[model samples]
Target: MQYKPASWLAAIPLAAMMGVCVGQAGPSQVGPDPTLPKPQRGLLPDMVIAKPAPWGDKTPTVPDGYTITAIATDLKIPRQTLILPNGDILVAEGKGGNAPNLKPKDVIAGIIKARGTSSVKGGDRLTLLRDTDGDGNYEVLTFAENLNAPYGLALVDNNLYVANQDAVVRFDYQPGQSKASGPPETVTPLPSDINHHWTKAMTASADGQYLYVGIGSNSNITERGMTAEVDRARVWRINARTGEHKSYATGLRNPTALTIQPGTDQLWAVVNERDEIGPNLVPDYLTSVQEGAFYGWPYSYWGKNVDERVRPQDPAKVATAIKPDYSLGSHVAALGVDFSNEAMGAQFADGAFVGEHGSWNRKDPVGYKVVFVPFRDGKPFGAPVDFVAGFRDKDGTTRGRPVGVTVDPKGALIVADDLSNTIWRVTPTQAAKSQQPVAAAQ
Candidate 1:
């Protein structure tokens, strides 16, 4: 296939091309290091993308003594998954975003990104997969149809909330129904202006009184002006009954996945931080979201590290920036997070599983697998460990890209692979007790 760049992209300065050779330390080194390096600016950000190489008969490689099998396949852009109470798995499958290309670099970047993604159209609906027998295979059924780019799923009481691109809607949900009986009712309007970062990651409070939704920044560093970012780069707290909402937390560039820690009311997020500074300057993180706290975006990152790119800098605001608890490495693009309780086995019984959808801004690509960060006393304790890998080949061709992750009713790990259009289930092998730990990729 012949690929052509936009005419304006040809006008990018030669200086932008010069920084392409600059290299940074490995991802593992940056994850645990407290001292962050100064930002590296370039005319254009490094773009070493892995082209999609669909899996024919291959499967993702898991840790030793763990078996991986496809529970559901032929999904259309399955971005997130939710395990219902009755053992049925609900998959949110859709894609919708139309941010204008305001800069010449944006046009070129878009073309490069589209090449790496699957050409399949999004389903724009949620699908339910039920494993009828004790076996691993699932019977697919359409749970809901005609959704407007639905990405987030939260069930509160008998109300199922779907965060569409423009609004949060509610549906009457029954315990064992295969489909919703009627049309959904609009709960509240979400910020759809410019529609830059469209994925709204949402979760309900344990008591089902409030819903928390993550809204991402409209631009990398507010180049389009802060006015375009109203109620964005933050998490919103909404009343489940009345749909009244307020900003819960601010300054998160992209909190792609939100979940409440079991046994605690505290909410946690897996954030995708800002990019284009350097290969390893700002690391995406997993952090406990404090109500009414600022995380620092467009101005500073990782708490008080001022990004010189934003004009009219606010030193006072940077001073109040709170650092994240754990770093997942720069540009990892972490999109899914779930805590492990009564997990698959003893090995995974005490940690969080994060699905890294992979990276495009670094010279060396990272994060095409699922990782586990051990937690003790409700806090991330050790370095992340690789739970599943081999998404990208030795030559950098991508066999799959992992998105949403959840623990099923049977205590198995379920991963959504959008690029390969499949959902993978991982279980502990019979001999898992005798195998060594798998070291995570940096």
Candidate 2:
């Protein structure tokens, strides 16, 4: 079924229907707001899409001490990034989802959402980038081609694991190699049928003994039924050698990105909570993922805040729901998260950098850039600082939206801009003083 361009007209009445007042909840309501308003259901979720406007000669704005530059451009939907031991950057460039439209509204919503994404087809491969001359600019090369839509990347020992949409696959990795020559070996099958949230965020343990995969729920509040949510809305821990897997954490609607905190064994996740529950009800969060902990998905949110819309409720399940550690604001769509232990400069050296992919379900768009959430003693400390901005222009046109983020070997920040198909490099002016050559593949 083709999505009509005029389908957006169907969403125009959403603001009045929901009584949406933009900025009702300001930045004060961002982190762990003590007062969360009651959920307000709308017949159709509010649609505020930022139309794509490619970055002509402009770059993203950064904080005073930091500068932004484009390292590579003309990529096809780069989502996540992995910095190799030899300083080579591996970019997973693809997008894949086949969730069927459940209603007429779904069709209209799909059309509006599609308008925000890149028009170019996905590359469906891992592209390698290397700054051979110690310059900020990178020389791009195709590392591997003709694969599924890969999202997460993890390198353990000599094995590189790729979290494809449907499965986790393993490939042989060499220290400075630009290409992965052999076919991939499937490690474990991921739940992908009726994939409402298709991204499978994966991270490996520091010892390389275990793998963690984040699988999102099938639909908002299980509207698609519980049968579609089996083995989902949770993080799966897999044996790197045996492929044996079990649920590590549960009840997260969409844990978009996962990472292991440095100097500790604790695992953390950035979750995208459910929508259609007012513009400021459920807040997206970043929390430490505990083994077997339930963070509350369809039945509840933020501890025991029961979502009445999830019918045939389970009071027992809601009682077991654990509250998230910190909230990143409602509809922020916190996607990419990484610690700053190995990051450059003092300002960014103690926190997590999160890539906010922006929001479409709110009357006012939020989270169009990257932010830094400070950490003290391995826990979130203060308010989130806006590290990168300028994704959305004054007229609300999106020049680019950030997805996956990583810190290069020299500690410079690397951001994958999917809308503009560009990889941006952020470096402190001081760090740029000592340039180091990127080792070229033999």
Candidate 3:
């Protein structure tokens, strides 16, 4: 697929379809709503809420009693993020360490070199640590080297499991190790087919027993099927202790986020839908992952319903796959996801937050913000609500694109923005205070 820069307003059609009024520059879309309830105050605009040195893209407006702060900046190329037990954050920057020395021609050369298996470009891994109290700034804690598009990360016990482009490896992670402690352990030797290598997204169970990895399909929808030898649009569960692996479920085009529910241990995968189909055709989805179940990819989509355009190749198999539970907008490109437990504030007690990476294929751009999917008894209820927005400016220019999301130990939301190479910390007032211990009587 070829990529060309287009007006960011292309995403307006999607927003309008969702009942959001697109405002013109001179006048607000809804006009002065004296009669309509006032937009509750305390919600900071993009400029004010994001403080100190607000980067590109004008400031955004937020809801009541909440604020956004950029805890770090000048990151090379931030991707997936994980909050360590000790409060330090772990970030996965894709091919970023090589940024300082790489030129435009070098990047083009790297892409061309990436065409074959023998070509190995270096400098893909680095870890940033926010030492707030020490020096009041975030810095690189570790500068790891020689990784191939490393994306997914899971810290089990003292071991850090990483999903490289071709295999899953483990490194001994000391609580404060600046470098990998021991030799790399090759857990799973995946097929290193350079073509469809979606081997970069995964998450581990809270208990640290199993690791869920997403190996997205090579093609939009393979003509053979999603399960053939090379067609890998599925999630796999690995025994964290033994390295044994099994297919957790199947048929998701790119189930980027694989999160295990806090209390129930149930697994959920937020998948990005297939592209090229008309605007609202195939719904991108967030759903519970059942073991041994097929999720309808390739020959089928959105459940057992066959995608006529791609179904002729596997007419016999569509009868078995299951449909998705919740449908996000088509081609919105939902990626990072995490569930908010009761510890988080009242509003997010039992909700799931997703970071939509934004769309390039649609006539209009879609998904450059965070959305919340409410859950009752561990199941999604009603439609998803917009939790965080305003990644694009009023003039339709995108300044940041959210890729990974995780709730911090203090219950604040942590989002990784790839475009700005920064991480945003979203905290609700009273929520952090609730986490603090009662002061001594004085």
Q: Candidates' TM-scores?
A: 0.94, 0.93, 0.76
Candidate 3, 75-128: lDDT as tens digits: 756778888777778877664112221223223323322321111232367575
Candidate 1 residue 320 Cα shift, in angstroms, is: 1.0
Pairs that collide in candidate 1 are: 28-442
Candidate number with the higher TM-score (2 or 3): 2
lDDT scores of the candidates, listed in order: 0.84, 0.85, 0.64
Report the lDDT tens digits of candidate 1 across residue range 1-442: 2334545556765444333577555536334345577788866787766778868888899876789999888889998888888888899999888888876677667766776687889999999998888677789999998998888899877898999888999999998778889999999999988888999999999899999999998998998898998899999999989999999999999899999998888999999998888888689999999998999997899898899989989999999999998999888899999987554656666789999988877777889999988877778877788888999886779988898898775678889998888999888866764443222121
Deviation from native of the Cα of residue 375 in model 3, angstroms: 1.2
For candidate 1, what is the lDDT?
Answer: 0.84
* Top candidate when judged by TM-score against the true structure: 1
What tens digits encode model 2's per-residue C-alpha lDDT throughout 1-442?
6556366555656554333544354445555544588778756777776789878988899987678899899999999999999888999998988888886668766777888889989999999999887866688999988878899999998999999999999999889889997888999999999889999998998788999999999998888899999998999999988789999999999999999988778899999998887778689999999998999888999989999988899999999999898899888888899887444676677778899999877777789999988777667876788888999976678999999888765778889999999999888877533433111100
Q: How well does candidate 2 match the true structure in TM-score terms?
A: 0.93
Candidate 1 deviant stretches above 4 angstroms: 1-20, 26-33, 433-442
Q: Count clashes in each candidate, considering only residues at least 3 apart in sequence or on different chains.
A: 1, 0, 9
Candidate 2 wrong stretches, greater than 4 Å: 1-23, 431-442
